[model samples]
Target: MAEKKTPPPNNNRQFAVWGLIILLMLIVFTVAQSGASRPAPGETFTFSDFRERVEASEVQSAKIDIPGGVVTGKLRNGEDYSVNVPPVSADPAGEILDGSGVPYEYAEKTEPSVLANILLSLLPLLIIIGLFFLVFRNMQGGGRGGAMSFGKSKAKLLTENTKRVTFEDVAGVESAKEDLKEVVEFLKDPSKFTRLGARIPTGALLVGPPGTGKTLLARAVAGEAGVPFFTISGSDFVEMFVGVGASRVREMFAEARKHAPCIIFIDEIDAVGRHRGVGTSGGHEEREQTLNQLLVEMDGFEGQEGVIIVAATNRPDVLDKALLRPGRFDRQIEVPYPDIQGREKILEVHMRGKPMAADIDVKYIARGTPGFSGADLANLVNEAALLSARRNKLKITMREFEDARDKVMMGAERRTLAMSDEEKAMTAYHEAGHAIVGLNMEGSLPIHKATIIPRGRALGMVQYLPERDQISQSRQEMIARMAMAMGGRAAEELHFGYDKVTSGASSDIEQVTRIATAMVTEWGLSDEIGPIAYKDTDQQSFHPGIGRGSAISPETAKLIESEIKRFVTEAHDKAREILTDKKDDWIALAEALLEYETLSGDEIKALLDDGTKPKRPDLSGGKRPTVSPVPTTKSSKGPKTIGGPSEA
Candidate 1:
């Protein structure tokens, strides 16, 4: 049996303290209000009536409160009455009362004590100061320490007893895991390397794109070594006050020294680790001071023998050079996007508890998702399970996974978007042109699917799904891709007359232009441009009065521009020639898209191979089922610009 723990009594004590403060304020207000002038316990009488009665000698006794301006007396009939009077020392009523020979006394005005007067004056100031103290105390996270702990490190310590995540929880980045395994060994037994006079790595930097499991790998190290883990973000060290960040760095390292064998994990170190003097504010900035302190703490005169620092950042290029040297960050581990087999393994890990259909193939899903990170795969599995639950299915099927992949890559289907007949026909022909050109081009990727249904910002799209992950592209492949991009505009101009062509091909023109420019400037595909790399100058480097501009001269710039234009013109001609030769096939495919709205790779191949029309499956009551688009390799979907000036 487990022992049940109760909340601490300090919470009740704090509440009681707050209640007492409120009660004291209320008592002060009540006492001040009680001292104010109040009506006497008697019928209010006019001053003239009281004077006439006093002159008749009907009043027996009376008392006058001078400050309160009220006169109270008892009549001969024993009735009590109060009369309003002026609060002046010399009045005719006083003389009349004295002449009537009625026994009366003047009530003396009472004065507050000296201490009470001082307290009443300072009450508002005290309350305001108390409120400020309470706000600062709450902002300091309620009694962790004092209100002015701005220089204290915000690092949270996680002991081994917390929820443990081993290497099994991490997948898809095997190389990064392997590189960190030695750090675990060092934490377990430092003698293995120390015997040979080899010091353990002071720090390891995990560099990768976002969502590549960098932070997860760090947690796995702590779990494997069964050591304490101190985690904080790079931004947590910085503060608005100068020297605060440096103080925090010193405090964090001092605390880390207490638990010598522990690991300090800094997530997103780029926030504080950027190059120092590059900013316009110069090196005296608070962030630079923090980074300087961090550099010294990692490799300064005093040794941090058993404490290992693990940092993760997506932007390694922005980090300071001194931080990446031999003693500071000894190992720079690259956690790149997973390949096909690694993605499959990642999928299997994510699908551990999911109720998957028996016949579902994980490899197929992995193949279709070429560039998906581990986090992406996890999201895909979650999305698939949600879709299955939505359809009231017991197990997650292949169809559900495919639909989730589509939704993850391309945006959800815009089923309610109503398009005019003319717009719909134009979209169909435009997408059909892309598919036709890609199918005919020798080195182009296989056409996966084509659809006129709007998904994301695209009014229509043709997806090019690569069979394998492409590490690099050849010259032919690049040319073929440009031709495919030009295909959409080429079809629009041919079907509608040149004058009637819409601005729907604006995205296509942009894609073609980008590819042509890259081919000329960076890829060295142009014969005149030669193999020399003419890339853009680094704009981030600071040089006073020197504007960051083009690296090449005007003459060379004009030559590059002409080469880009030549490549685009050739691609455009190639697309037009292909469309003219395969004119009947292109028209048939467009008509099929008009009827079905979408076509898969197999269905399209069958349609173009022979003259057979592709039939959409009638899944629900003789109505055709809507087929959504799939993921693509390059440019997922081309935008269909409408109501804009056409690009030349």
Candidate 2:
């Protein structure tokens, strides 16, 4: 093992060293002054003799003369001095006073000379202390914080008791939680495994998108371990200096060693462990050095004993392989978007302290939020509670939950904007078309709610909540979904004629196009194209390069386009047939939507059952049935449901 380099002294140590140096200087001055000031052995001389001695030297001319004494002029070699001569009678040696006696007892002190001597004596120490402070401050990274404390690592210490969150606190992610169970056991009772000569893994890497509970899992491990946890960001190890990042890495490991059987979590490790030489730059020395040191600490000659290093990163593909070898990051756990059950559990966890109305259902909310993470669910609950509070409601209602989900998914509502009656009817029909198609189509995803209320940049939206998380899709299911996506525009064309077709289906069109293109070019589902996937030059952005089997001719492209259009046309015709047969049902749903503006799946299914033959409360007048307008484009007004079926 290489000897770790000692970091430079911190401020407290620097101040202590300076204090000791000053104390030593004062002691030396005291000692020298005490010894040198001892009285000379009975030596006395009259001022007259002093003047003669001064006159004989080269420095005598600079001396000043005073009253009752003979003194020379200003001296050349030394600074000017005024020396007062004692009376000649006071001199026991009786040396006759010279005619020009020098007054050597009194002289003005030179200010410049005193200052120069003091500076000369202290200059080197000041320079050294200043330079030391400069390096330390630079290493520390200044920003009005304690920038001079370079040797102190910037890691947050979390002990089991200090962290209020245990594994039980992190709801959802059952599989991930199960995967971490062994880790918890390893941390809690290392001797159980090590007694059989089993070595514990040095690290585990959590890979997932943000807000997927990566950090929460790490905390759970620490809480389960019941040991010290050191938490820090990957950027905390970096510094502008060449070796500061490496220095921080060394210090962090040293700290972890102090508390053995500990867990150290570094969030977003890709900041320091990016793949080397993949980009234009050869490699960044700071990050490289930090990662290198981290590698060494993980499995160097002196391997990390009883220390587990866990890290989380969203982009694990860009990390260096050396840092992810077997001894290090031994297990890679993925925390993906929550499934339906997981989402329900997560919602329950987040809804703990809130007062919910009886109508509020966790399962419904879970179904509505198809792609929400645990954190997102928590945020949704909190946002709903906030909305309830804002409305001065005593408890959270289902309306608030719905509004919160919409706000989170599609941004805030734009209620103040005004729309023409025609536009409102068009948007209503557009969204109604989507809801009807999604409900009627086989293998279509379940509809959560449909609304014509403008939100975000959309004039209207139809939200379909998946029953569960699906990792794989069948070709039939994909086609059915694409057709459903295109159903809004197709419905507009069939019912309202071409005049009412709006660009409200832009997103839907894009989705359908990509699905159709992929089916023909990548999925090899086209019969004319055979089993070979056609190489799409446009694949650089959307499709992978290797999926293409051959270059497609123009004829094949034309055939693919026709096949796609035929598929869409058949789906559209099927929807029209279903609607035409159930015109009364469609009108009932449209009227209910116009009244409430939204409805859950249960409400819609109930409507579908009784909608076809709604009984009238009044039948006293014997009359032929009145045929209502089909709510098509030619009908400038909204559809009316008089609770009766009309002939098609």
Candidate 3:
């Protein structure tokens, strides 16, 4: 592996190195002074004693370094001594030797050289420069959360000149593209709109679910306009220090103004634009201040003519009212989940550089994927290619794509999960319950698959395939949907005795409960609720779980709970009735599951078809008709009597 690159050494370290050099020079000067002032090996003497000795003619030869105020001499007995005396006189050493009248040679004091003079003169300036360099480096190396550099906007710009993504690269969200086409035209030629009475739109908001290509749409805008792009997240505007977020907001807009006709994309704008006056502290905090600054920059003093703002968020419900008014973000373009034809186009775009088998059909794949987003489809295509490569195939085949889709929707296959024989039998019946009820239910969704292999958190899964995109649902369809969700547990209770039914339908139970509760409380489908939505949310701001702190009486709350339970129980009864009449098909499907371990929609259809074929009875005369009747609303009174404790 390559080594991680590290930052180079800083000025502080160089400062320490220079400081050490200066310290060493001072230490050397002290050592030289000490050595020069040392007395010779014989003995030490006071200044008066040394002068007396010198005057007594005991000193034979004396040498002095006047610059350092030191004298060294040898006596007549050949013992050497040295002295460091004060400069009491103009020539203390020479005068001392002359007063003694001893034989002594004088050495003139030497002057400092030109190089040493220059170094000494510049030493203070060099130390000052090192200090300044260290301080400057510290300021320049300031990191995140540091108090010093708050005004710097954290927006990252696309530096390269090349266009990485054009309109062709973005495969979905055609409506959003159409809305932005005007913005691109405005950027290309402002006169086209300015010539008329049209005032250019200050901003456009792209609202959608997480993986619906909101960010990708922004890039396509830049690539189409051929303008510089400045991209930042709303969270980047916040900082720990007070007033920092507002400062960053001002700085980001100022930067955009530098590059005229530029696109500034702020992703996840809800982070900074949440509804004000929330919680006990209210809007006095820094987030409100940051939002206030952003509002001003977008349209207040700076009218934001040359720079167009494109903000995106999955939670538009929480944004402040002022931030999303008509003057600012005048157009709210929703990038919704793709339709069938759109999904096909998205899949074809993703399949561009990959080898695929001729039999693989994009339209068929799109039909099976009912609720997949753009990102989901892209990942599906990539996963299919990887599965094909794993099998060492030259091109991805239909079988690999099927497995990939199954893995994406359900978790990865767990063939080695090792289920006991009894457990496997119970799972087969539970899944077969879903298949039988889903197929028999009137006006219910289609069943794409049923499998008993362990995937993700569930031991088995019954995958339903919706025929077309459903923008809304009718009351009957909602009830049928709930019944299909509860079919698994109902089948288990019928096949195995009520006392022996397993908790394998916990997930299914949860799904039905949510749908039923929404039907009564949110969707107002219940007759008792009278089409009034008693929802727990603030409608104006669209913020969930913040509904003006309204209170519901205990009696009304009880009634809501009862209605939810009644809806689910009714659906469970319908599912049980349908499964009981088709006992033969139910058993046949379980047996099929045990034998095959999995069954696709077509395979399940064939199994049910073969099971329904007419067969001969024993040679003895048949007693009563052996044929089973298809269930209807006539006999939906079986499982409603016994209350099975099915906990989700």
Candidate 4:
């Protein structure tokens, strides 16, 4: 276990220094002012002495005199030690000064009003000093409550023992893992490489989609190297004030240097490293200046070995090219979604502590979740555990796992929602269209489940499981997939006509649109845009510019649009025809949905084969028999409403 940290105690010596300085200054000022205000040693008597003598002459008073403007008085022999000055003649009992240091002329004290004078003299200086201390405290990280820590980087620090995330902890992206392993070794044993005149690369960049384990890989690198790790988000380097961002970058790098052989991981570095000269969107001077400083530090000539910079970004396209240069980034590791085996391994790692039933098939779950990333898998297990807890079960069963997977992929279950009879019928037809079309496709995933149940925001959903994980998708496979996505809307148009088409198929429409767009603009599947990608490289410029190797004018744009339209139209036609031919199967599937409000993959397959799902002979207990088709897209209809571009 990692040790807990405690704050350092206050310094008594520093406190003493300031306290003594304040005391000495006060004493010096008092002594100097006292000397300046006092009377000299000796001088002749003046008019002041005559006034005192005259005042003393009137009888009971003692002798009095003044010299150098200072008054003196003595008591008469008849008196003890007191002396008195006579009052004015007409008012003999009027106020007067006695020789015991009382005022003679007025009620208030005259010359030697020492204490008040000293305080009066110190008042201005004290006010100035008070204001100075206030300003001092403000500048010295005091008086703003916790505001002073605002500029500090909020990056978390992790070491080998605290992190415990080695390469073994991260699954999938085996190639990327292998590359990062070398980076860890380089950090640990730099001297060995240096003896052979080889310097370790200063930085590595991980570029991939979100939830692909980029940050996790960084932690693993730290653990494998067994060194101090400083982790910060790219946004942490930016601030409202100009130059503050750059200053922070400098500070971060400087702090990392103290550890020498350590990793500094900046997640989402594109926050600061956007292409410069793109105007406002490149971000303000703060971000730009920070990027400049980061560039300098990463590839600076005063190169330090064993100090590595690791950064992760999902959008590498927007990043500045200068930052990605050889000397700066040095290596670019792509962390993509896992393959079949990789997903199984990832699921296994996350399932370590979960109480899963023996019947839970990792492969089945992995196949159903085609595009899931490592993070998504982790979330799946967590969601399943919660579902199990909610049901008050001893352990998580396969059903709970299925619900958890759907909940994570889709939104939460919308149980309170009630669908109208018309809406339910339309959803059933829509999902059944997809299932039937998918079944007819030559090489598509097998249907896992088809249901019109309102889980998530969708009125209906279909899940298809690939017979096995596919590492690469063929062009035919992509087209077949797009056709299945269009089936929902196609069925609505077929049954209710175009006028009755509902927004229920909006998601399906969006998926098809993207696929169609990618085909023409990205993949060059259209002959009109043949073998060329028209994707705007310079997103900095708003207007679309000319493309290379082609003279595509207004007519070409129309042609491209026509190709996309034709592609969707053909897919829709194919779905309508398939569903029409499989009308009996479609009705049977819909009836099953109406009865149960849901259907598992096997149950649906059983419905297609016979009129009902058969019981599982192997499994015991009174549970309803859930069918399982020997997974094949050709022989079986895939799940109902699931269609998307596969992550693999």
Checking candidate 4 for backbone clashes, the offending pairs are 49-66, 447-638, 447-639, 448-601, 462-640, 462-641, 462-642, 602-627
Better of 3 and 4 by lDDT: 3
For candidate 4, lDDT tens digit of each residue in 136-240? 545644411223444555556566665377888889889999888888778778877878997766789999999999998988888887888888899888876
Residues 1-648 of candidate 2: C-alpha lDDT, one tens digit per residue: 111233543466556656866865665565455334222222233455454555575334322223233333345455443334543434321232233443333223223356456655776787677667657765566522345445457777776554356777777788888888888898788889989998877898999889989999898888776778888899887776667778778888898999988888999999999976654323377678778888988899998777889899999988999888899888898888888888888888888887889999888788777778888898999999999999999999998988898898876767675655555556666666777766776777777666666777776677776766666767777767766666667656665677656566666666666676677666777676666656555554224333334554556667777766666666667666666666666667656555555566677777787643233332213332222233333322222110000000
- How much is 306 displaced in model 1, in angstroms? 3.1
Query: TM-score of predicted model 1?
Result: 0.85
How are the candidates ranked when ordered by lDDT, highest leading?
A: 1, 3, 4, 2
Q: Which candidate achieves the best TM-score against the true structure?
A: 1
lDDT of 3 by residue, 426-542 (tens): 777777887788788776777777777787666776777677777887887777877777777888677666776665666677667877878877787899866877777645221
User: Could you tell me every candidate's TM-score relative to the true structure?
Assistant: 0.85, 0.71, 0.74, 0.73
* lDDT of candidate model 1 versus the reference: 0.80
Off by over 4 Å in 1: 1-31, 42-44, 55-58, 73-81, 91-94, 121-146, 160-162, 279-284, 539-555, 615-648
Error of 3 at 50 (Å): 23
Against the true structure, what is every candidate's RMSD? Answer: 6.3, 12.2, 10.2, 10.6
